[model samples]
Target: MNPDEDIKGMFDCCFTIFYQLKGFGEEILEDKLVHKLIYLLPESWESKKIAIIEAKDLKKLKLDELIGSLLTYELMSKRLIREKGKKIKEQGIDINIIALKSSKKHQEDSSEEGSEDEEMVYLFKNFARFMKSEKERSKH
Candidate 1:
């Protein structure tokens, strides 16, 4: 798979989820899913959409929802890496598990025990690093 396609897929998946959540109800814009979508997004794209989404005050979204989304995306990314490992190995390619682990570990390290917002904030800050690493792996 091309790196561009993979990045586009990630963007499309999160955007679709975000849009659906946005249309669900008045408070749906404040959903943790929205935060996770924002968190997973690359810095390149965040600036364009974040202003629109952040215009809504969603500070009241429960901690459980926020953390849940973070964990869900983490698990999904891990599973993708694991599944792709087999194909890379079969092709005798150098696998970059370090990058994947670093991305996930960064999430775990940054997330505080009592807050999801903090974790999301951390993710937003590191989005560029994560995207670069994933793109490299996909190219190999």
Candidate 2:
């Protein structure tokens, strides 16, 4: 398969999995199965893929950085859930709560820090001021 096609295919699969799980209940999103599907998506898909995943904590995320962080969190959540499930299955007990706690922590850690827009805003303001100053000088 072509490199780009493969990435698109993987992203489509993840999208399908997310929609399918959504039918069962939002709780399925918290399940390890969904997380694994999300993890299967390529790192390059992180920006586009993040827009599809449902995250409660994403409210504070900046639009520009949200996509990448969301993808990273999705991948981490899936891995953590998979490992937790494997251990529980072997030990004959469910550690869903523990998995959730750890996944939340990882998500928080993976989320992008600071706002890029703030710097852009400062730069824009400076440029505008410079343009206004130039206009005044030209009038003189």
Candidate 3:
């Protein structure tokens, strides 16, 4: 999976590839599909991946359910990040500086081989924008 692409985009791309493979008499089982999708997720999604894997029988897990769960996780993460930023701003601290510093610190700390999913990077980008706009609103 490409970490730069959104989860939905990644799923769509995989489906397209699967369609092509079907023409060549290569058929992948729905059960195995779930495994591939979960395990293929970026390292940042490890917890969710593990949860999905352990909480249900792979043979019984539908593709729609997997995608729904992933999308839910993404949306929840975004909301939590936004809410945290808002609360920090209300505390009269400069969250923008903290966000930038922590993000950079994270990158510096991660090994070259370790990477986060697109969802996290997306959340951080949105959080930075939210903080910037909030600062501008306060200026007015």
Best by TM-score: 3
Which candidate achieves the best lDDT against the true structure?
A: 3
Cα displacement (Å) at residue 23, model 2: 31
Model 1: per-residue lDDT, tens digit, 4-39?
444446656666766776688534444655555556
Instruction: For candidate 3, report its TM-score.
Output: 0.64
Best of the two (1, 2) by TM-score: 1
Which TM-score value belongs to model 2?
A: 0.24
lDDT of 1: 0.61
lDDT of 2: 0.60
Q: Total clashes, candidate 2?
A: 0
The clash numbers for all candidates, in the given order, read: 0, 0, 0
Q: Candidate 1: which stretches are off by over 4 Å?
A: 1-57, 94-140
User: Can you list the residue pairs that collide in candidate 3?
Assistant: none
Query: Residue-wise lDDT of candidate 2 within 45-133, one digit each (tens)?
Result: 56545755655333344433533555466577669979977988998755557788777867686544224556778899999999999
Clashing pairs in 2: none
List the candidates ranked by TM-score, beginning with the highest. Answer: 3, 1, 2
**For all the candidates, what are their Cα RMSDs to the real structure?**
19.1, 18.1, 18.1
Ranking by lDDT: 3, 1, 2
